[model samples]
Target: MTCTLENHRAELASLLKPVFDSLGTQWLPVTSEQLCDRITSEDTFAVLPIPAFTNSQMDGYAVRSADLLSAAPDAPVSLPLGFTAAAGDPQLELQPGTASPVMTGAMIPAGADTVIPVEESATGTFPELVRCGHGTPSGQAAFTAPSPEGRFIRPAGVDLAAGALVAPAGTRLAPAMIAALASSGLTEIPVRRALKVALCTTGDELSNGQLAEGQIPDANSPMLAALLRRHQVEVRTIQLPDDPQGFVAAIDELQAEVDLIVTVGGISAGAYEVVRQALSPLGGNFHHVAIQPGGPQGYAQLGDATVLCFPGNPVSALLSAELFLVPLLREFNGLPEPRPGHYPLAAEASSPEHKHQVRRALIRDGQVTILDPGSHLVHDLARADALVHIPVGVTQLVAGQSIETWSMNV
Candidate 1:
């Protein structure tokens, strides 16, 4: 059936829907270790902590704040040194009428209520011993300054109780996420498997050997394969000669193995449109959509597998893949919605008729700046960092009117 571009996109999406929905339960569930091969997400992960009692905010005397209540500069309280504590050292418990020397992060032992700064103590000097001299307030300090219970200590489970969903699902496992996952004791991730797709771009014109008249080297097959793998699709590519019997025989051998099949060319109206003709025997259709570069696109079915066919022109082939193939791959992979960047509209190409105008562009400052890869000039596509879609006829982008664009991950 002939489909308008929008209708085709909808149909394409609909066609692949069941493939995902009916994905049978895996015979063997995948583990995190197995996912290292294909799982790739850019999602943020939560923090994984290594437990420790951190140092106090400053170097100070460990005492009950109350002991220092009456301790002013002139009559600075001098608590006898009961014990001393430093970061990463043993907790020091102080006795009544005395204080312990403590550094930042030292554990507060039993009977200590608060930490008074060393500055508040007679020994305000740092890097020195806790000097509790003979006349120091060894006997009076505890009675004067006291702190409330649990003042400076971070009680266990205060931040996050263990087993409290430390690592939530849907987080893109990254390096930091690796820590969280490791902390969660997950050595392997359970993720969707890499989709396997097969490709066979057909044309009599394509060859690596010396070219004859009207023949051009095949760029679409290799290029498409490269493009597919870049976005994480595990692709198997085959180049077929233009002969109808040869193509049909090739497909007959491929259908049972692939989940999806994408053909590069020969689905157009021309006499040599072998794919449209040969696949018609096995069910494939090539018809015009309301799209320019990808006007002649098609789809077909071979038993359990489906084929998405694109025009021979590299631009057309790529554009068709972007619009049709990407959504399908994403659906198959169970990935989040594709994130597209935007560039400013550079060229003055606008369609007042309001049909989706798919153009090439470079994304800059979160906008898609337009650049037309003149329908015939497929090479121009190489210069583009993104693809901008000026959807259907709202003509005239006066140098900088914001238009929605679909940015590819090129």
Candidate 2:
């Protein structure tokens, strides 16, 4: 049966959902330092409270609130200053009717319930003390204003409490989440293992080295490989000729080593279709999808791997990978789906009457201008930052008309 673009995507999701679900059950421990872009396999909790203890939020004087209750500009309260408390210093006890200098992030001492920033004191800075009796420095801090209890004091667990949820299962860890995890004293995290893929590009005219007449460099393999890697799929690429037996042998060798097999070219109806000829007898379903640039598509279950086939043109192959395969890999890796947005057309455009057409476009000055729609326009595809999707039955679009678009920046 001929499938619409939406139907094809839904079918692919249904076929691959179970495979990814099974893979999610397996996980490995990764260091917190290296957990960026990794998905959590299970809910993780903080081992310790963020900050671990009550500390000062500024460079100030730690004092008992009661000591400055009656102080004012006309009648300032002068109290002897004790030891200076800098960050990493051991906790010290506050003496009665005295203040202690405390830098930002310094642990608040016992009996100190409030902090007064250095600028709020009479000197506008910490007092320079001179050695006095008992080898302790002697000085005094004069306060003219009263600060309420708990002011400028960052209490323990103020950011995150011990045993609180750091991240939930299936969360893709970002940089901020990694910092939070590290602050919680967690050295390791449990993350899902990455999915593996085998990428095969087939054509007799494709070559990576010096080319002769009618020979072109293999562009699909590198393009697809980069896209797959960006979604955390470990990829191994192989270039194959128009020989059906060689393609079949390659699939046999890769079936046990990869979770998916993606082939570009050789699936369309032609004199030298290699992928379809080799995989059709193994239950592959090759058909036309109702989408331009990437209409000829195929999928199959071969041995222990799922196979996907795309058209030969550079633009067609890249568009197919973005539309069909990228979403599946992102979902499997717990990354957010690339949602489509609506934008106004910069100029008039037309699409096929029955096929959903995707044209390269650029968003400039808040409007999207459609580029060339040819499937072989590889250079035009590079200048596009968005995919303007004109659905089936949308034959004509006037200027200033809003159309659905998927961002290519991600």
User: Which candidate ranks first by lDDT, i.e. highest?
Assistant: 2
lDDT of 1 by residue, 61-93 (tens): 666655666755555566666656767666655
lDDT of 2 by residue, 1-410 (tens): 57899888987888787667766544443453336787888898999899889999999899999999999999999989888888887887898899988889989989999999999999897767422233585779999999999999999998999999999988888888887887898877878767778899998899989998999998888888988888877799988768889888888888888888888999888978999998898899999999998999999887688888889898999999899888888777767877788888899999999999988899999899999889888888888899988889989999998888888955
Give the 10-residue window scoring lowest on summed lDDT in candidate 1. Answer: 22-31
Mark the regions of model 2 whose C-alpha exceeds 4 Å error after superposition: 24-34, 129-135, 337-346, 365-367
TM-score per model over all chains: 0.65, 0.90
> What 10-residue stretch in candidate 2 is worst by lDDT?
25-34
Off by over 4 Å in 1: 22-178, 207-218, 331-355, 362-370, 390-402, 408-410
Model 2: per-residue Cα lDDT at residue 161:
98
